[model samples]
Target chain A: MLYLIGMGLHDERDLSLKAVEALRGCERVYLESYTSCFNGDINRLQEMLGKEVVLLDRKDLEENPEENVLAGGEVGLIVMGDPMVATTHSDLVLRAREKGAEVKVIHSSSVYSAIAETGLQIYKFGRTTTIAYPEGDYFPKSPYEALKENHMRGLHTLLLLDVKADEGRYMTVNEGIKYLLMMEESCLQNQFKKDSKCVGVARLGGDTAIRYGTAEEVIKEEFGGPPHILIVPGKMHYMEEEMLKAYEV
Target chain B: MLYLIGMGLHDERDLSLKAVEALRGCERVYLESYTSCFNGDINRLQEMLGKEVVLLDRKDLEENPEENVLAGGEVGLIVMGDPMVATTHSDLVLRAREKGAEVKVIHSSSVYSAIAETGLQIYKFGRTTTIAYPEGDYFPKSPYEALKENHMRGLHTLLLLDVKADEGRYMTVNEGIKYLLMMEESCLQNQFKKDSKCVGVARLGGDTAIRYGTAEEVIKEEFGGPPHILIVPGKMHYMEEEMLKAYEV
Candidate 1:
């Protein structure tokens, strides 16, 4: 049996009681650390579950899932957010099942829904996009284009920042804003403006810090850490405006 | 301090360790029961947390939030799924804050992200809409229009089935499909086809059941009970197609 569990967001205590109970009965536990940023203390998690958790990189889970799945016992693969949110884990489920392993998924909190803490309407959100830290000339402008389309439709966009967890590199919201500005300069798309209001969220689910301001203000403001998300609101309802006031810097 | 905690999906054990610990210290715990359907045993939750959970309706939360907030002590308002996903809760947060109450949200798993378990790319979803149980002339066709727009944009739509939890009435997937088809007939829009493929998901996060098939097939197929959601997939990637096969009936 392979149990794909979600560690939710933030600390080990973010894990559900069901997850804790299941981890106690697992023979082997592996935490996939490359996908998302989870600053939780592994030793604390180990103490709570009474199980030894081995860390697995992107290659271990993506290229060589069989090595983990073929263990032939109750193996647990802990994902940072909801287990199947990443397509890689979904493929892992198929691979595990094909290898004659019974798979069970224990879902937990994900940044996708937790973004509502910013008081932005979830249903009003359009297709979510990610802003990656450009290496050399490998910058991508598709995220900017997607946000542009959502803006045109008067829908909000949740921009997820790239995280290279293995390298201890997490893209800050400030960097994400700068990337958008760079894209605007290159593409000459008049979508993003200096005074455009956006919301920057940091460390959600555990003592979160949220600030709502224009692109100029947000880019200059210090959000104070990783696991940051940017929300570009398109059209705001009066009620939404009222709720956002609580987070305005 | 007012703590808005999420119970996740399904049962009592689905509550996160953080939620449990917070509830233990809470002087008043009220479960908002009108928004979504949570078939979890309340007694079991009380037994586990050692706290008696009170039930709050839409009126208690919306019209008179002071009843839940003015306690001048730590109050926990337990919500099914992620605490702030519903705009009503966001309004509650604002109201609580206005009443000089400090607010902290404990996030949990939500159907918004859990639907990715069906192999649909979460980023490809656009503008989620809900299908309400038609009441007399109050039948709305906006959900169908939203799904049509998503289809045009080659984006998937997550149709949340409306639940009247207070009345003990939950909308089934079959009723949701029928509602869409009825909307199509009234609007004279050829937006939906009988042979169009759709995914019906039920009781996610606990004993989850998924079935993928054409609208004709899914509508005729019984998906057991309540708390069902429908997914209308757009252009599918080959990997998504392969992953969805596991759910195809």
Candidate 2:
């Protein structure tokens, strides 16, 4: 049996009771750490579960799943946030099943829903987008395009910051804002502006910090941690406006 | 302090370790039972927490929050799924803060992310829509319109079935499909068809039943419980197609 458990937002303590119970029955536990950054010390997680959690990089699980993830016995793969958000994990589930291993997913809090902390209605959110750290000469405009389409339809947009967890590199909220401004410069559609209202959230589900203001104002505030996400509001109802006002910097 | 904890998808066991810790410190624990149904018995949840769980309807919390939700010391308001997903909960957060109560949300699995269990990529989902039971000759077309827009953009749509938990009324997956077909009939846009491939998920995170097939075929399967969600896939990548194939009834 292979259990793909989610280590919800924040730390080891975020593991659901079901997740903890499943982990106890596992012969081996492997944390898939390359996809998303784990916000807490792993040793604490190991102590709580009373099981050794082997950290596996992308290659270890993706390239050689049979030998590593599905070697033998009951295996538990810990994924940051919900496991199925990324296509890679779903691919892994398919692979595991193809090898005749029974797989179960223990769901947990994901940034997809955690952004509700911003007081924005989750249903109003459009297709989520990510701002990747621009690689050499390869700047994609799809993120901006997604935001624009959503904004045009009067829907909120949750812009996920890029993270190369293995390299210890994370795109901060400020960098994500900059990426949006750069896109505006290229497209000149007025999709995003310096004074455009936006929200920057950092370290959600922990000593969280939320700042609501213009892109320029929020960029100046010190959000004080990694795993940040930015939200660009489209048309706000009076209630939503009231909620956003509560988080004003 | 007021702690709003999520009970995740299925049962009391789905509560996160952080949630349990928060509950332990609470002088009063209230379960917001009107918004979503609780699959597990209240006695089981009470037994696990060792705290008497008080059930609150919508009026109890919304009408006079101070006398109920906020009339307390270290209260824990357990919300099914993520607390912040609904605007009502966020409003309560603001109201609690206004009354000088410290508020913290212990996030957990929400249907927003749990739908990933259908083997569909979460990122590919567009704006979510809820199919509410039409009342007094007033049937809304917004749900269908949302589906059309998402389908036009080649993004998957997560159709949340409505639940009147207070009345013990929950829309089944078949009814949801019927609603969509009715919308298609009225709109006459081939948004959904009897032959359209879709996914019906029932009781995710527990004794889950997932069936992937055409709308006509899937509606024939016995999902066995309430709180079912329907997913309409957009243009699927080969990987998503393969993943969906795994759940064929």
Candidate 3:
């Protein structure tokens, strides 16, 4: 049996009671580290579950999952946030089932849903996009394109900042804003102006920090540490405007 | 302090350890019952938490949230799925803050993020729409319009089946599909053909059921019990096709 458990956002304590119970019955636990950021320490998680958790990088899960799945007794592949949020994990579920392994997903809190804390209506959010760090002349413009399209449809865009957990590098909200501006300048689309209203959320599902203002005001503001998310909101309902005003820094 | 806690998708055991702990310390706990479907028995949740849990109807929340917020001494408003997914709850958070109450949100797994388990990429989903039980002379065409727009943009549409929890009326996937077809016919727009492929997901984050086929084929298929979700997928990635094929019942 392969249990794809989610260690909900925040810390070890954020794990669902079902997840804790499932982990207690597992023989081996492997935490997928490449997908999202988990603020909790592994040692604390190990102490709570009384099971040794081996860290599995992207290569191990994407390229070589058979070894983890065929480990005999109940094997737990714990993922930060909801286990299936990442398509790679869903692919892993397919791989496990194909190999004749019974797979169960223990769901938990994810940043995708937690972004509602920013006072944006979840239903109004369009296709979510991710802003990644550019690697030497090979930058991706899809995130900007997605935001623009969503804005055109009068839908809010939740831009997830890329995080390489193993490499200890997480994209900050400021850097994400800089990249967005650069994309706008390069495209010369004028999709957003310097005074465009945007929202920056930092450390959601934990000690959250929210700032809502124009792109110029937000870009100059500091949104603390890692796991930052930016929201490019489109037409806001009257109630939504009032709710966002409460969170305006 | 007011705590908006999410009791994940399934049963009482789905509550996060953090939520459980916070509930343990709360003087009063009210479960918001109008937003989404919670399969767990309220008595079971009370027994597990060792506290009396009161059910708050839509009127109790929307019209008179002050009563819930002014309960004094660490009140907990437990919500099914992620606490903030419902815009009403977000409004409640703003109200709580207005009353000089410190608000802390404890997140949990939500259908918004759990839809990825249906083998669809989370990032590809456009604005989510809810299908309501049509009333006389008040049939809503917004959901259909949103679906058409998402389809135009080549994005998947996650149609939430409306549930009036207080009234114990949960919309099934069959009804949702029928409504969509009705809207398409009324609009006379060839947005969705009878043979258009769709996916029905039932009982997400629980003993889940998934079916993938044409709209005509899937509407005839039984998708178990309540809390069913329909997905009108746009262009599928090669990997998504492979993943959905695994569950093409």
Please give the distance, in angstroms, between residue A153's alpha carbon in candidate 1 and its true position after superposition.
1.4
Query: Residue B81 in model 2: shift from native, Å?
Result: 0.3
| TM-score, chain B, predicted structure 3 | 0.96
lDDT tens digits, residue span A1-249, model 2: 999999988888889989999999989999987877788898888998897989998889889888778886899999999888877888888888888989889999998999998888999999999998899999999999999989988999999899898898878889999999999999999999999999999988888899999999988888877889999998988878888887898
Kindly give the number of clashing pairs for every candidate: 0, 0, 0
- Over all chains combined, what TM-score does candidate 1 have? 0.98
TM-score of each: 0.98, 0.98, 0.97
**Which lDDT value does model 1 have at A42?**
92
| Candidate 2 lDDT score at position A223 | 82
Residue-wise C-alpha lDDT for candidate 1, range B1-249, written one tens digit per residue: 999999998777889999999999999888987888777898888888787888888887788777665556989989999999999988887877887889899999999999988889898998999999888889989898888888888999999999888788888888888888888788877776778889999999887889999889989878887789999898899888988898887
Listed per candidate, the RMSD to the true structure in angstroms reads 1.2, 1.1, 1.4
Question: Per-residue alpha-carbon lDDT of model 2 for B1-249, expressed as tens digits?
Answer: 889999988889889999999998889999987788789889988988898999989898889788777996889999999988977898898888788788889999998988887777787899999999988898888888998899989999999999998788899999999999999999999999999988999998889888999999998988888879899999898888888887897
Q: What tens digits encode model 3's per-residue C-alpha lDDT throughout A116-235?
A: 887788889889999999999989999889988988888899999988887889998888888999899888777666888889998888888898988888888887777888899999
Ranking by TM-score: 2, 1, 3
Off by over 4 Å in 2: none
iRMSD for every model: 0.7, 0.9, 1.1
lDDT of 1: 0.88
